[model samples]
Each structure stands twice: as structure tokens, then as C-alpha cells.
Target: MSTGFDREQGEFARGARAAVVYPDLGGSSRDADARLEETAGLALAIGIQVEDRLAFRLRQPKPGTLIGSGQVETLAEAVRDQELQLVVFDASLSAVQQRNLEGALGCKVIDRTGLILEIFGERARTAEGRLQVELAHLDYQAGRLVRSWTHLERQRGGFGFLGGPGETQIEADRRLIRDRMARLRKDLEQVSRTRSLHRERRQRAPWPVIALVGYTNAGKSTLFNRLTGSDVMAENLLFATLDPTLRQIALPGIDKAILSDTVGFVSELPTQLVAAFKATLEEVITADLLIHVRDVSHPDSEAQRDDVEAVLADIGVAETTPRIEAWNKIDLLDEERRAALSAETAQRDGVMAVSAATGQGIEALRTMMAQRLTAGHRRFVVRLDPSDGAGAAWLHQHGEVLDHWVEDDAAFYEIRMAAQDHDRFLARQDR
Candidate 1:
């Protein structure tokens, strides 16, 4: 299948003819500005050069264009003047509103969710990632399928029986999309099951799994690459690494552990997206440790952190789960200010300040991560009689054994593992 950009036949080459519009529907103007920044970030990520931007303080949204007929007319002139091929709204649009906006602007109109979905579609590389993106795209389009593909009906081909009845085109298309969605869901389920199997296998390995998560463009990918010494496309753009990537890293004083970098979270993420990306985020939910990487240099860093934590909770990653807050981009601050912030961070539990780009405070951060990750584990050496070798094997399966040496009396095993592993080991000994 062709990528979304390819399907456009190089329409995005001169750069996605684009504009950003937002409704100043109350709240702080600073918030509205931050949202525009986010939309700009999205434009940058999708290779779209934002030609123009329109924002207004609206008393209430119009049902047709979402802003108002007058505003739509003004935006239409801007779209024409800018020769925009796409109008990206900073807010979610209803099906009718999206179609009406396109008709008014004489260009493709996409909501924030749709734009982000397109970005994900183009960036998805792995098979599982592609399938998940397709699933999310289909689910998103399923609701507004009529508005998006209505123009396709005018195309003529020898496509006969596949076309079905002209009058039932909408319903027929809906059924086709629904059927495809069902199949994609099943495939994703298989993908999820396979991932779970891998996780189970990893559980028996000698290392713990650490997941890195945060808001988009918060530098999680950069930090992941910095720690793992592997190139995984650490860009300054949003959603640069859509697929979750993992690498092995040895900590300062602890054994090796698998460090996974998952996709970033965003404020007011569409529910359809959350549902579709569950398979991808399962890596975070099941991780033994979570490293919440925050861009402390961002103006809305605190709000972004809240948004990420909220999404993590919504995704069923228990708040009680152990997490380390990595306040990144400290080098972006002035020396005095950075020092002040670092002192403040020292007062916070399980929090550290670092810079992924400059490699400042990275060693200390890694040591903190390693210590917190293995906080409860204790080392033990156990001997198993010949008759209990099977039970000893079970112990090894459940714990990380640092070494194994055999003696004539018994098989000696040295392990460093969680307290639960020790309990299970003791139970096996009794049996």
C-alpha cells in the first residue's frame, strides 16, 4: 500500500499546502497560544509548511464551519491567497462541520486528530506499527467516511460489482470499512498476543524492562538514544519515532535491562486513537519501571506532564507503579536558573534534572534509575539437592541468577531478584 504522502502524488512536495485555525473558545489566551504551537509542531512533523494561521475569539461555535460563516469567509480568502491545499483546525470537528469547512475553503480540511493520524501513517515503519496506524486511521475515518471520500464516487472505472449500488454507496463503503476494521482488530489482537509472549519471555530473562514515556517532542527518543548508544531517529519533531523501539543498556551498578521508548502522549488525545494504540502502549503498561521524560524548557512543561500522567492512568498503568521523572533540557536554562531548578528538583522524590543533548547529569540520572529500578531486589545463594534440580530450575526461571556453580553436595545458584521471587524459591524448597 502506498503511503499517505505518496497517495497524494507529491501534492505535499511543495510542502503540504496548509493553514492553522483555532477557536479562542474562552480560557487563557496563553493556553490558546500553546495549542497553536502544538499545531505548528504537528505541521512541522508532517512536512507541512504552515502558510497561514487564523484564530478568533468566538462566543459560540457555528454548527456548519465551527467558527462562523463570516469567519469561514475570511478564512476562505486566506486559503485562496495562500493557495493552501489543506486547512488544519486546532480543534476536533464534527463530520458535517469538516465537510462544510472543506467546501467553504475549497481545500481538504483535517481536524487535529486527522492530521496527527496522517503523521502516524507516514511515520509507521514496523509491521505492527503500520497495522496499528491503519487500525487507528480506519477507526477515525469510519465515523466521517462520508465526508472524506465522497469525491471518489465521481471516478469511473470498470469497477463493477465491487461498486455495488450507486444509491447505497455510503452504506456500502461503511460496511467495507467496518469489515476492514474488524479484520484489523483481529490482526492487532494477534500482534498483542505475540507481544505478550515476548514480554513473558523477557520476564524470564536476566534483566528488567524500563519504559520511557512523555508528551510529544519532550525528547524521550533523544534520551533513549543517548542512553542506549543506538541511533533510532531522535529528531526535534513530534512523533518522529511512532513505533516503540527498544535497546539493551547496562546501568551504573545494576544488571542490564531492556529500555523501551514508546510513543509520546498529547493533551485531549482522541479516544479512538487511544483504543487503537493500546497494543503499542502495552509495552508501557507492563514495564517494570517507567521513566517519564519531561521537557523542562517548554513553557507548558507542568501541564504537559499532567497530560502525560493522565493518559498513563487512563491506559491502566497504575499510578502506584514506580516511575522516575527525568526533567530534561536543563541545559536550555541559564546557569543560575538551571542551578536553582536543580536544587528544587533535589527536594522532589524520584526526580532528576538532565540534558540529553549535552550529556550533563546523565551518569547521575542513570545511577538513580538503576537504583530505583532494583530497589527491592536482594541477592541470595541457594543450593539444590540432586533430587530437587527441577525446583532449582524453576527458581532460575523466576529470578535473575548472577551465576551458577555446581558442587558435589548440590547445585549452587546465585541470584539477585525481587522479594516475590525469594518467596517462591522458599516455597519450592519446602516442596
Candidate 2:
């Protein structure tokens, strides 16, 4: 969708002209500038034009406004000067703080969580993605529901919310929100079950699955398209690809592998979204291998990697899951720096420096993926009856046939396959 400007007129969209503010409490491992840059990127993702970006150093957060009144007045001056319609706070603002800040700043106020929910709300295209976003939004709004109605005293006579005999307007609204969220949860549960069934079927098959994971706008979709040759909305915007896309690709040694591109992670992603998107994230948790796509050109690439790791840990990715680094966007670097990195990474075991857009080092990356996925395969020997054409074909299709011979009117074959695949082959024989 076209954003931030009207098609008919060249006017800025309402609430699109804004400022991004970060409150530095001196607790975060990252400095203030990086946080502000990310927050501005979040704003720009949804077509918001950031007229001003500011970071304030606070000795302690105020209970009412999160920042000192002096700082609020200064921000208000900037807001009025810049003619901004919205103010985006980089920190999580409580309901009270948000209300007070709006009153003082003389403009609309949104915290980081609210802004992220807005991005997800707009970018979610699939039915399941919309459902998850709605659930997360409701979860966020439920806590901040205000009793601002002049007729809040009006209520029904019968029993209602909280098992009470009557319900206030706010309480009734909360009840409706809760009821909708409950229905969404049940629907999502069905989706999750279906996804689990699909994943189980893929596992029962011989093909391995690789999931691409990293921070938002880390060039994962580009890499996925480069690897699989499928166009799946690779854009420069954050959260460009909200829904997961899976495609079958052939590796050097493997006949087929399932490559999955998943939603990009962000720093301080809303907990509601994490809980809401559990079904979608199952792909990452269950993947046979994870390729972490990193934007090596970004100044905070290391910190971004840490944030991705934090989310992975929060989502319960197993320690046993094999992972490799794909240092992407090297083409953005100068020639000398890119060449040095390429030379440095070529000797590394689990790292590859490449540009997805330029197709540099892509073949080496493919080889590395195939080797990692097949590293744990076991060698096995099987004997089949002469009439068992299907069995022999299965062995050849699902495994690397090291040897084949005919002995005593039976077929003897030596192959390399994953343990689970071997078990499935044996199960077929028993059947």
C-alpha cells in the first residue's frame, strides 16, 4: 500500500509526520543512537515520515510521564516546531505515563509496543497472520482500556462481567474483547494443529528442512529467493514478509530440501505477538538446521544478532539445533573491506560471507548447508527380495546409495541416510 502521502495531493498523511524519542536509562547494553535509529526505522516502515529524532538521558524514569517535565516541555517545543502529529516513545509506556505524556506534549503518543503492533497490523496479509495480529492487538489494548465514557455508570441489570450482577461500560467492553480473543485463540489452536500435522508429514518424508532466521530487514527473503528461485516479496522495509513461505530447493548432495523463510525478529518484540505467533514460529523450532542471515553492513550488526538470539531463546529453540551464519550484504561494503571479510570467512567452518543480491559465494553457502544437514547421516545396508521394486526405488530416492549388488537372488544395497529416514524405511518393510 502507498503510505505517508496522499495520491491525489502531495500532503503528508495524518499522524505520519512524527518524531521518534528514546529515553536512555543507562541500563541497556546498546547506546542511545542505535535505539533511536531502529525506532525511526520502525516509523518509516509503515510510511511514517520522521521529522525529528531525539534521545533524552534520564537519571530515573518519572512515575507519571516516564521523563522529566522539563524534557517533556523541550519535546513539546520540537513537536510544535516541526508540526509533527505524533510522538513515538522508544520505551514501553504505561497507560498513566502515556496519558500524561499526551496531555503534556499536545499530540498523540504511542510507545514502542504500540508502534510495532501497528506495523504488524498493516503488514499481516495471510488469514492466519491477520488472526494472530488481531489477537496480539486485543491483548495489548485490554490492559490499557480506559473508563473515559461519560455514561460509564450505565450498565445492564442482569449478571455480566466478572460474575457480577451488573457491568460497567468499560467492564462490558473488556468482556467483549476477552470473548473475541478467546475465539481467536481457539481458531489459532486449529491452525497450529494443522501446521503440526504438515510438519510431521514433512519429517516422515526424507527431505530435510532449513529455516532462515534473523533480525528484521536482514535480507533473509533475498537469500531464500536466491536459494530456492521463488519470488517471495523481498523488500527493504522492516517486517516486509510477515507470513512464512516454504519452497522446495535442490542442494548439491540432496535431491530436495524444504527452505522456509520466517518473520523477521526485532528488539523488544511484544510479548503478546510472541505468544500469538507460536504456531508460525514452530517451523523455526523444529527446523533441522537454521541459517542466521545477518546484515554485515549495519553498524549494530553484533547487537542485532544478540537481539535475534534473545528472541530465539525466548521461543525455546533447542541448544542442539545446528546453526550457521550467513554474513549478507557484503556488497554494501567497500571493495577492500568486502574482500578482507571474504578471505577471513572462507576458512571458517560455520560462516560464509556473501551478497544475496549479487550471488557472491552462493554456491559455497549451498554446499555448506548440504554438508551440515547430512553430517549426521548414518551408513546402513539393506537386503530386499528380487520382486521388491518399490523397496529398491525407495532406497535409491531417499538415501545416498553407496553400493548395490545382487546376491543369492536377493538385492543388497548400502546407503547413507538420516536415522529417522532409515527407521521409516524399515517400517515400510514391516508393513
lDDT of each: 0.78, 0.83
Candidate 1 per-residue lDDT over residues 22-105, each given as its tens digit = 788886435777878889888778667787777877999888878988888899999888777777898889989987887777
On the 0 to 100 scale, the lDDT of residue 241 in model 2 is: 90
Candidate 2 per-residue lDDT over residues 48-68, each given as its tens digit: 788988999999999999999
Any residue pairs clashing in model 2, and if so which? none
- Which ranges in model 1 have alpha carbons more than 4 Å from their true place? 1-14, 28-30, 147-172, 378-417, 427-431
Lowest lDDT block of 10, candidate 2: 156-165
Each candidate's number of clashing pairs is 0, 0
Q: Pick the candidate with the highest TM-score.
A: 2
Give the C-alpha miss distance for residue 149 in model 1, angstroms: 3.8
Q: Estimate each model's TM-score.
A: 0.84, 0.89
